[model samples]
Target: MIRIATPDDVPVIHTLIRELAEYEKALEEARATPEQLHEALFGENPAAYAHIAQDDATGEPVGFSVWFLNFSTWRGVHGIYLEDLYVRPSARGGGHGRALLTELARICVDRGYQRLEWSVLNWNRPAIGFYESLGARPQDEWTVYRLTDEALESLGKRG
Candidate 1:
């Protein structure tokens, strides 16, 4: 059962985020708090949205996918940028991940989004294969760039 997450799901969501970070070997950088999650997803101007997969019989959340909208200048259409997609190890191979991804793709098609994009760690071969199986290819011509906390602060002071 995949559905939009509500405020009440924060605790479980927080746990899942931490679990995912640990899986990615970045547990030390996982500083998300309940308050931060709430503000990002449910504040006056929500920045993103989340979908949770729950056990059909037990009603316990097993995984989640969170995303935000992005605009492609070339295509002139808004698309979904998937930020996080995680399934508990026990839930893997159960089709939950595929189902969640299928739903997100459906949303893109229905809404006429130009593209759906995300990044996988270079070492995560399993994820790369899964994405390839779904016909998502890596954009070899482009490199992802980011400004960390300190860099962002410095940019502001450079003026």
Candidate 2:
């Protein structure tokens, strides 16, 4: 069962985030505090949203998706940018990942959005194949970039 996250789920979500980071070999980068996550997901003016996937029989959360809306100038419609998606190792092969993605695709279709997209690490063959099996083709022509920490602050000072 998948449901929108609530304030009470922040700790679980935070745990999942750390678990994912560890899986990706970047646990040090998973720095969001549970309090920060709570604010981001359930704050007064939240721009982020999350969905929790539960074990149907046990009602225990096993995975989650964190996303936010981004506007495409060409499409002129808001599309969901899936920031993170994680399923616990113990819950692998239970269809939790697909369920989470399908829910997002449903939301996009229902809302008339033109696209549903997210990035996958090039080295994650399992994930790449999973996405391909779902008929998702990679946009190989594009490259992703980011500015954080000092560079971000430096630019902010410029602005």
Candidate 3:
């Protein structure tokens, strides 16, 4: 079962995020606190939205997706930028991942969005394979870039 996330789901969402970071071998960078997440998701002006996938029988959350909108100039429409989608290690392969993605796709289609996108670490073969199986193509022509920390501060000062 899938449903929109409520404020009560923040703790579990944070846990899933930490678990995902661990899986990606970057746990140290997963520094978001539950309060920060709550404010992000439930603040007066929400920056993102989330969905929870519940265990069918027990109704316990087993997976989740957090996403925000991104505008596409070429497509002339807004698309969902999935920040994270994760199923608990013990609960993987139970269709939770696919179910979460299907829901997002449906939202895109219903809202007339042109695309649904997310980035994957290069070494995550299992996730890449799973996404490919759902007909998701890689945008290999474009390389992702980031400016953060001291570099970001320097640029801010230069400007």
Q: Model 3, range 112-152, lDDT digits (tens) per residue?
A: 99899999999999999999999999999999999988999
What is the Å distance of residue 26 in model 3 from its true position?
A: 0.6
- TM-score-wise, the better of 2 and 3 is 3
lDDT of 2 at 36: 90
- C-alpha lDDT (0 to 100) for residue 55 of candidate 2: 93
Model 1, residue 93: C-alpha shift (Å): 0.3
| Regions more than 4 Å wrong, model 1 | none
TM-score of each: 0.97, 0.96, 0.98
Model 1 scores what on Cα lDDT? 0.92
Alpha carbon lDDT of each predicted model: 0.92, 0.92, 0.96
TM-score of 3: 0.98
Query: What's the residue-level lDDT of 12 in candidate 1?
Result: 91
Residue 106 error for model 3, in Å? 0.6
Whichever of 1 and 2 has more TM-score, that candidate is: 1
